[model samples]
Target: MQAPVQRQCSHVSTCELFPKFGLRGSLRVWQVFYCLGNFEGCARYRLSCEGRAVPASLLPNGRELNIDALVGKP
Candidate 1:
């Protein structure tokens, strides 16, 4: 039997939020749902494709992230 292919966002390596996702366990869900799956539905992916500025706080579900809180910043 053949192994199933895994689809991931092409910009994951360059994405600012990609690395941050690993810092918090809760953020992993976003990576699993968007970075590794359904990347086409990601807001960041869509913005990048359109040559627009993708905000670091933008989430795949079109929500803004309070990353500072997640990372213990003031």
Candidate 2:
């Protein structure tokens, strides 16, 4: 058996992470990772996508919402 290679994306995206702002107050780098949000019972499975860099204050007003209300949470 062998490990598979990852894919890349050429666009920006918005995703939800737990405890809202898990990496708050910082800029992120882009990569492919599984998000534990964006679906019902989000953590059970993986939501794969490009892990684009986002800011802690990326959300409006820079305040961390309990959940990414615009989308939803895990």
Superposed model 2: Cα runs more than 4 Å off:
12-26, 34-74
Clashes of 2: 2
Candidate 1 RMSD computed on C-alpha atoms after optimal superposition onto the true structure: 0.9
Residue 17 alpha-carbon offset, candidate 1, angstroms: 0.7
What are the per-residue Cα lDDT tens digits for candidate 2 across 1-74? 97765443222244433224345433221122323212322221222323445443333223444444424445
TM-score for candidate 1: 0.93
Model 1's alpha-carbon lDDT is: 0.92
Name the best candidate (by lDDT): 1
Work out the TM-score per prediction. 0.93, 0.18
lDDT per residue as tens, model 1, 1-74: 99989999999999999889999898899899999999999999999999999998898888998989878899
